[model samples]
Target: MFSKSKCFVGGQIWSQTTRRITKWLKEVKSSTIRETQLQPTCSSPVYCYGPLLHTVQTAEPKLFKDSKTFVDMRMIHSQSETLDTFNKLMEKTEGKPSHEELKQFVNKNFESGNELENATLSDWKENPKFLEKIKDPVLRQFASDLNQIWPGLARQIRPHVIENPTQYSIEPVPNKFVVPGGRFMEPYYWDSYWIISGLLICEMPDTARGVIENFLWFVEKYGFVPNGGRVYYAERSQPPLLASMVDLYIKYTNDTKWLKDNIDTLEKELKYWLNVHTVDVNGNTLLRYYAPSAGPRPESYREDLETAKGNQALYTELKSGAESGWDFSSRWFADTDGSLNSIQVTNIVPVDLNAFYCGAVEHISNFYSILGNDKKSAEWKNIRDEFRESIYKVLWSEEDGIWFDVNITTGEKRKQFYPSNVSPLWTKCIGQNQNMVEVGDRVAKYVSQSDMFYYPGGIPTSSNRAGEQWDFPNAWPPLQGIMVEGLANSESQMAQQLSFNLTERWVRSNLRGFRDTNEMFEKYDCEVPGRYGGGGEYVVQSGFGWTNGVILEMLNAHGDELTADED
Candidate 1:
């Protein structure tokens, strides 16, 4: 039912593209999912988003703290047998099970901790040269500890998972990779970009290459990377970073043969984004975060059901918000009420998403040039040029002095102070005619005027204190990386200093959090240094992959200059 619509951009007719709509249920109803019965097929609705999943997630008093605990657990019996037993149990309990009953059922029916095995990276070095660069003794020791965390975070899928994939939600990949740790036992999509960067910094190119190879496998099989390594995530992707990961991999390893071997898979990943996620804004093409899947996410099932309250549109929007990796953020909401019900993620084109795509394509072009394929290089270069122009034309707010996420329906700028506004600079998504020095000055001025420097922990995700994890008080690792790296890329000295100042605050916060808890966190409260973030579906998690990566990257960039002295 998708139809292309013509776009009028600056008095010129642009190419046609499909729009994301609120018909998730309609698509699901028409999909090939089995209408009834639970089976071992990954595509079976029963396993992914049907009665069994729903019943387990919504059990009275909740047997597990996180709903994801149930879905990720391996079934001890066959799916069909498990469903049949569950049906009989439900009938015996009149379809309403107590916490104890559910606990016993789960204990008897499933086994936990069998999906992934801890992998030891053979290339892990005890002391990389980055440690020598750090002038501060305390900070250097902290960085060393973070380096040690790599072994604990590295994971590989178990043989049973590959053999009996349908018994678990985790996706089976061919190579050993790093997981984000804690309850996140599977390799995620966007998190890997930072993880890969950290791996290269640690001088583990083979480990990094293995991680990228897994992503290539995902692109070959799913036509795009899933949000994470799980069957439930098959419906959507996080931000596109596969190409950027590969680009960094090549820079570190100089593995041209590897790049030449897998360049087609990289191209296929980019095409999936271009063909599916593009939107026409006044004839200009831009990308937005989207999740075409129906039903509550298997990981956050209970919370999504409660938030959506039977509204299928909200369910789709919630899923899209998850796909944005800023799950439950005020950035995606349509209203100022600060409620999840107001989320409308599919209605807006995000600046960071487009910048990531543009940057990725630019790398693709560079990668081709490296392989001496001038024709393909020029083709992607031309596409990259067009994308940058479109971003400037459609997302740049000249008066506001920054890029903004625009609403797709009304084509209006979402003027706000999310760190993502300056993401174009990090991705080098500027227009061809723009002066780098002036752009840098303007971005620096924007940060100063926004009072983003007021926070001691790091740059807050947004100016809004909307009680969501992505709003005020909370600073994410990736957003901090985006802001610091983006501003530093500017030719203006002020921007570079601003980037360093941010690095100091962010590193100090990571150090403080690690010293306080002996663990790294997923997000931190910028307003309160050393405090982990709050107000998400689950407790703020530790063993955070990207947080460690960003910290390591900052250490690599500013280790010699960073100090632990408060003064």
Candidate 2:
């Protein structure tokens, strides 16, 4: 009664099932299908009634002896039924796969998994516990929204209790904490440090500690943490934030023993910077930190010969004095003296690095004092004070009203307009007079300017539209967030306005970008208003740890006033 085509399809299904059974029988040589108990309620229903019934209802025991026949027949019928249903669906859709429609179907079935639906901002706001932990409603709202964007970010950021743990070290891949970005981000060691601040603010101390421990593990294992754990990532690291991360960890844990236990390792890291990374020429220590002399290239090593081809020139070349793998290394070359030298010259001395190093020395001194190592503490203090003096004298440019990095040997100030100049303010190293005011004014000007630093969303990395702008037009949440705090410290009214303007722009841009594309990109091309750029390899969304974390914390720090919060 069936049509020729139906018979042909059924015959094909039967043949396929027969072949499968034959293969199975060959594999299970002596064993019968009966030995392998098949469930009655299999995936398909047609198997119960079709060819299987015929094979099982046979009178001869020999026919029943090889249960493989029954099993194969059942599989044939089940497959045919499935094929028929698929064919019917295809007919209805005119042979289209219906991928989108199917996705909708699956999503509907798993509607509960939707982040916004599950953890609505309204729900977070209503939670008294969350409100108590994060007193600011704006911050709470921001966190709730971020949760909607990336659900596990907040939980992954919280600090946890480590009991009976291994030595205080960094694990490339922690059993408990997995950075959402994964192993691909091995080269971004210092970047992770900046991202950790957001986690700390979220009360995710465990996650923060785990990240620190992992870095320490890296330091203990490899002398310095490379840009990443992969072999290819061994060459370069991002900006060094080891000391800052240590400070944060100490603040949260208050574990003096942890500091004491790791002080030797920390000191070793510092020594590595001094002896290996920095070069001593004419009694002055010149920093040689970064390598390959190219700006923001994906590959850690230098791709070209002529040292800093483009925007990469904006960064300094610290040849010898990197304390951590994340510290900069100098480009390799032969000096005019015909001697192999690691060139420590950088795009600038970088206000941030100097400030961070100063802070590190101070922390080291404090730790030593606490440990009753007065001699060591005093030694470190003297070094710290000297570095502070150098930072002020060498990096400050009175003409520009901004503190810039100087080629320590040449004594020429790096004439670059970058956010790094704002970092010294964070360290409170800028003295009185109009120094703070001048720096604040410059930052304010950059914020208000439309063609350069100012964009629809936030401050850009660099202003030269033609030049490579790492921070230009692309408002990095971490930098913006830090500046907000730094501005508060300076108590500059203009700085406050700049911070508020940038924050509001970011929120607006984020909303607009998300609306257009249902994800938060790594960096937004603020110049274009809604476009996102600068993502390499990965599908640059989802695991935006720093952006989500920093923004939430910054908003919280600002409290009800998203602009001017002294605290």
Best by TM-score: 1
Residue 71, model 2, lDDT: 26
What TM-score does candidate 2 reach? 0.60
Score each candidate by Cα lDDT.
0.83, 0.47
Candidate 1: global Cα-lDDT? 0.83
Q: Ten-residue segment with the worst summed lDDT in candidate 2?
A: 111-120
Please, what are the lDDT tens digits per residue for candidate 1 over residues 442-554?
88888888776669988888777888888888999999999999999987899998898889888988888888889999999998888999877888889989999999999
Best model number under lDDT: 1
Give the clashing pairs for model 1.
8-282, 9-282
- For model 2, what is the error of residue 316's alpha carbon versus the real structure, in angstroms, after optimal superposition? 12
TM-score of 1: 0.91
Q: Which lDDT tens digits does candidate 2 get at residues 1-567?
A: 111221122112211122211221121111112312322211222222232232222323323333222222212123444445545655776755355543332233222111111111222222323334555554555456665443343222112113211111112233233233422222246556656665555555665666677666666765655554332233344455677777777886787888888887676555444433343222333344544321222221122112334322222232112312212221111121221123343322456666666667778778788788987787667656655665666666766666665654466665655556677676666543346666677656554553644667666654433322243445555666666666666666887776666666666566566657755555667677556745222233445766665666555555455432225
lDDT of 2: 0.47
Steric collisions counted per model: 2, 50
